[model samples]
Target: MALLGIIRRWHLRDQIPIREIARRLDISRNTVRRYLRSETTEPSYAERRSVSGLDKYSVQLSGWLKAETTKPRKQRRNLKQIHEDLKELGYAGSYDRVAAFARQWKAGQTEWVNSASKRTH
Candidate 1:
């Protein structure tokens, strides 16, 4: 819209060349020429960053998560337990982060689902 206004003002009022207008506006000559010659409007540009975590322990996390799926005594460890274990193993993360990841992983376990859903409600 702003580009169209600039092009219209230059072509209809100032009589400037497309290249000159482009240079003065610090936009591309092709963009100015497109406005002067073509019918399509410029599209808006937006970049979307991915949602994946940088510190994903997915592989190790998965194995740990699988162990957690068993009954409390049978389960190798819980998140708080995992957090402590990870700390001992040189993992640099907050208990909250470890807990949060565990919660997400546990979401897939049917046995944990009822308890998690009940807590959420």
Candidate 2:
């Protein structure tokens, strides 16, 4: 790679063809061009450090969400009730956050079950 740097310098100072530098360096012509043209940079990806409150209670919440689906239709678990239940089960978090998590969890499960039911019929 350092040999490429020397070849690159020679090309710059002598106005030699880029193909000459690439062939002597034993690298692709496009790679030589990109190295000559590009600035050093870092790439990044967006990721959360942690899931909000759910990280602590995801397993319990998932179990409750599944239970809600398996219950009789008339006795479906509501967000407020789930929040209360979570509180009773040692969740030391805000009710609103728990309720929000329940809503999203229930929505996803409901969609899955509804799709499966349609497929069976």
Candidate 3:
């Protein structure tokens, strides 16, 4: 949105040419033209559908995370332990991938809990 505003200001208000705007912004002239021509305030992009190696093990990982949440914090297995367990189960992805998935899962869980609490209140 900010970029769109800047592009518009440079072209309409400051009277900067499209070629200059493209050069200053380090974008293609065609892109600058498209941005100027579009009626929307921001450019829209199609959603990407990229697959990850962790997709196959997501259900199992989620189960482990949910089960761990029921245990005492000191007794719960950390992400490293979960990664090793996944390795035993034939997950070939890196520990970083598992960690990222866990972070995203926990975020979603937090959002769900917050929304549920709001509904009850």
- What C-alpha lDDT values do all the predictions have? 0.73, 0.76, 0.94
Measured by TM-score, the strongest candidate is 3
| lDDT of model 3 at position 113 | 99
Candidate 2 versus the native: TM-score? 0.47
Misplaced by over 4 Å in model 3 are: 1-3, 9-42
* 10-121: candidate 3 lDDT, tens digit per residue: 9999999999999999999999999899998766779997999999999999999999999999999999999999999999999999999999999999999999999997
My TM-score estimates for the predictions, one after another, are: 0.40, 0.47, 0.71
RMSD of 3: 4.7
Tens digits of lDDT, candidate 1, 45-94: 79885554416565777787776655577546657787777777677767
Candidate 2: Cα lDDT at 78: 78
Clashes of 2: 0
Ranking by TM-score: 3, 2, 1
* Candidate 2 per-residue lDDT over residues 1-121, each given as its tens digit: 5655665676788887889878877878898788777665344569767657557778888887788778998998777787777778777788778777777877887899899999998
In angstroms, give how far residue 52 of model 3 lies from its true place: 0.9
